[model samples]
Target: RARPGLRVDAMVLSGGGGEREQEEHAALTAFCPGAELRLTVLKLADGRLPAQWEEAKAAVEDLRARTEPDLVLAPRTDDAHQDHRGLAKLMTTAFRDHLVLGYEIAKWDGDLGRPAAYQPLPAHIAEEKVRLLQEHYPSQRHRPWYDREAFLGLARIRGIECHARYAEAFAVTKLTLDLGD
Candidate 1:
């Protein structure tokens, strides 16, 4: 979870190209009240392909150039969704020296891979996260796999992997520890 005092900035690349984009904005605003939110709604006509990989990469590169954040959270490279995979791969180049955490999004594609990092969530925080997702994205609720069970079930599985009651998993391609810095 992002601490309230921390400055959090998020860039939402695609948003299903409609009301979902607006819903995402609203949800993110509520989730990170004081954080900076950037939404780029692109036309992804094909679910399996992105509009333009070079353009998306350039956009992300611009964001990185401007923000130069200490950490970046992006979609996992092996995500079943091609759009996500493309962005994830591009992120590796954009934030080459930064700590990037690849987040997993549960979907019907069922492409969950073994994650190397675990961020344990408190019971209440996990419940709240599920509740927020359900509340914020009414359009996604119609999907069979978008229910609480799927969300909580994946969290539970990840928790088991990390020896916690509830947790979120991330793929870490690289990391640098400055223990004595």
Candidate 2:
């Protein structure tokens, strides 16, 4: 039986802002330690992605041309933050042929769009993930919920969907299934 998820060949992160990408990078490493994780960085002016969508689109396309990943995970199209929303839309346009997964960063306004592909992290992995986030991203530590609880909490809630102990949510911007008859 084949698993549904794509074998992530290379991951292209939009930027290092908001600790979201950093967390994703961390999770990707822990979750898929054996796979190669490639990065494409676009450091746009913070909080100014909507107007600069083209720059992101171009950068990511160039990345796709180079890495040729089976799957491309980006931000959610509908999100509390404009950057997240903008990047999601741009990635959707760019990676039409690849499986694009959207990641969730908990916000006060709620996860604007429902996620499709959820990675259920084990309890210990979730805790260790929080620790890695705190240790590496020192700049975000003072910020609220950038700590252990929020990350672990989100995972716990997602775990409820399948009675798992902990988990992380991701949205699949595009996916295809082959149901054999």
Candidate 3:
């Protein structure tokens, strides 16, 4: 059966600042051009982890109630940060049937684990991905780990794991495979 087209809903449970959030939204739009986009901006502070958990979880549940998504890109449950882990748990709870791909955020904490799945990107597309991040998210350029080399290097490493030229990795708790009947 032919599936529905892409409709992506990105939930920014907590943002660092207004400018950062704007940059992030622009970057996401550039990356996923032509997709129906629904973005929720929650400007909760990092210090307020407890509050963020309840509010973000409730928002996720509410969104899931109204929309049926084919795929969900969320933070993994093994995420080092409290906010990310909490959000991942809630996303898993809310999206039991849907395909939930838990993505990674490479940071200094050394939390990168062996991802369970991989999606290969073509050479041109992978190059474009790095270019978009550098162009759209200028605010993040100051960060030590935000350079193009760092981004491409990680993609290369993940690609090596999956035997692709470039790839994004994800943690999958459960997946149903359909062998040809």
Q: Sort by TM-score, best first: what order? A: 3, 1, 2
Residue lDDT tens for model 2, 1-181: 0243435544333455556567666756655656655644456776887677777778767765776566666677777788878777777887787787888876666664556667777677788778776766665667675767787778888878656888777777557888998
The TM-score between candidate 2 and the true structure equals 0.77
- Better candidate number, 2 or 3, judged by lDDT: 3
User: Per-residue lDDT of 44-97 in model 3, one digit per residue for the tens?
Assistant: 786566666777778888889878987888889889988888888888889999
Per-residue alpha-carbon lDDT of model 1 for 108-135, expressed as tens digits?
8788999999999899988988999999
User: Where's the lowest-lDDT run of ten residues in candidate 2?
Assistant: 1-10
10 residues in a row with least lDDT, candidate 1 = 40-49
**Clashes within 3 Å, all models in order:** 0, 1, 0
lDDT of the structure predicted as candidate 3: 0.82
Per-candidate TM-scores read: 0.88, 0.77, 0.88
Q: CA RMSD for every model?
A: 2.3, 4.6, 2.9
Stretches > 4 Å off in candidate 1: 16-18, 43-51
Model 2 error, position 30 (Å): 7.6
In candidate 1, the residue pairs with backbone N, CA or C atoms under 3 Å apart (3 or more residues apart, or in different chains) clash, namely none
- CA lDDT of each prediction against the hidden true structure: 0.82, 0.68, 0.82
- Candidate 1 C-alpha error for residue 18, in Å: 4.4
